[model samples]
Target: MSSQQSIRQQYGTVQANALKLDEEKAKQSVDALNTDLANAYVLYHQLRKHHWNVDGAEYDQLHDWFGDAAEDAETAADEMAERVAALGGVPVSGPAALESHATVDFEGEDVYDARTSLENDLETYGDVIEAVREHVTVAENLGDYATSEVLRDHLAELEADADDLRGFLADDTLVLESAMH
Candidate 1:
């Protein structure tokens, strides 16, 4: 083959490979985002429930905090769905999908005590932060810097929220007691 034809063939092969790689990356991102989105939705509902049912001396404060958390989780879920759509993937929205994808579980029909509910929320948020961190790693490996950056920001925010909730749940004295116990 002539030099020009050889160059053209090589360019075509490179383009095909790049396209394949992009598709693969999108698939991986879609899976991770969908899982995170489902978990976020579950957490949002749980938080809303806690907001409505929390009582006792800290009722007002806990209600407000849980309400804010639910709002944030809803927003995060929406953003994840949008990101999946932007990547040409459909967001998983079925009940089975949510159940299978969610990493946290909330049990019982009654509203948990303030401490228990807050602890559950903290654990759920921690799981989400870890999941986002995994997604960030995948994005980085795929050379999808934009997605990686977004996931990193999300992970940071979730981690901070979890830490704040944890702090509220346990004062220094409580922590010291727990350590001694």
Candidate 2:
């Protein structure tokens, strides 16, 4: 076979479904979904780093908490990637490729204490939720109901995790702050 014929690629080869909707629009939605997948991976990395590096009075607790968050992020990433494939698009990946599609940056360099880690993870979750919220509409407008549903589910999970983290960070023995609600 010729070099072109022998080439193996996951992208530029997507054959969007003919009977569902506009192929071009489906590809566009898939591209956007791949971006979310990348962003979820970056967020997962942050969660893991914070989980293992956390220190201070609540070291053990935060460590466990971040582990759960990391697991959730991993789940989100896997779902997003699958959705991309289901839409006939390849999942954006690799450290560099993921970074290129990521909606937010990860803090891989700095050493963070428990408080700082919570703040950073909360912020990252917020960013993912924000992007997912927008993608929900984008996916729906493109007639991609499945992708829209995925984005909506992801948005809810991320928001719940963020709320949990915020409550843990803000809940004081004497002053309950906003966690009471």
Candidate 3:
């Protein structure tokens, strides 16, 4: 490990009841939330990838929508990590760590078909939702109400994202004839 790594690892020990939470339970909640943070990071980048590369007659609209979703993911990740820190735990910060810790995987092609792209995005959202729900219970069981509340809100947001994507996919009134011109 580098000197910086040694320093951070050495003094990074979490203290109990720093945030008025049970130290052990807070640490447990933080551990679970670190995984949530990492997965959110993965989903943020994946959403951005689709936002930047998706192609279709509706490229502009989808790109804009995905960009907003990516921003939301980024915010969620940052907030989750901040909560971990607030709970006196170290958030997983390295890309490799984040990737290994993430439950969601990136599977969309560099170029994507519209419905497939939407479906892939929904899958990513769904994966995060599942993880979020699991970790929310962890937080609640630990009496980490702040963390639990944040995660509950995140769950709602993810569901809205999925519902939005599913709605677009279900819309059959799309007309692409004019775009072929």
Q: Give per-candidate clash totals.
A: 0, 0, 0
Candidate that would win on lDDT: 3
Candidate 3 residues lying further than 4 Å off, grouped into runs, are 1-6, 9-13, 176-181
Tens-digit lDDT string for candidate 1 (1-181): 5566433332101122333447667777778888888888888888899998897666777789889988888888888877776665777777777888877675446778878888888888877787888888888888867667767766776887798797778755423545543
lDDT of each: 0.75, 0.80, 0.83
| Candidate 2 deviant stretches above 4 angstroms | 1-5, 8-13, 174-181
What is the TM-score ranking, best to worst?
3, 2, 1
lDDT winner between candidates 2 and 3: 3
TM-score leader: 3
1 or 3, greater by lDDT: 3
Task: Write the residue-wise lDDT of candidate 3 on 140-167 in tens digits.
Answer: 8888889999899888888899999988
Model 2, position 7, has a per-residue lDDT of: 44
> Across residues 1-181, which tens digit of lDDT does each residue of candidate 2 receive?
4666754446744566644767787788877788888888888888888887877556677789889888988898899888777666677877888898898999777887667778888888888888888889998888888889888888888989988988878756543457434
Model 3 lDDT-worst window of ten: 4-13
Task: Tell how far residue 99 is off in model 2, in angstroms.
Answer: 0.5
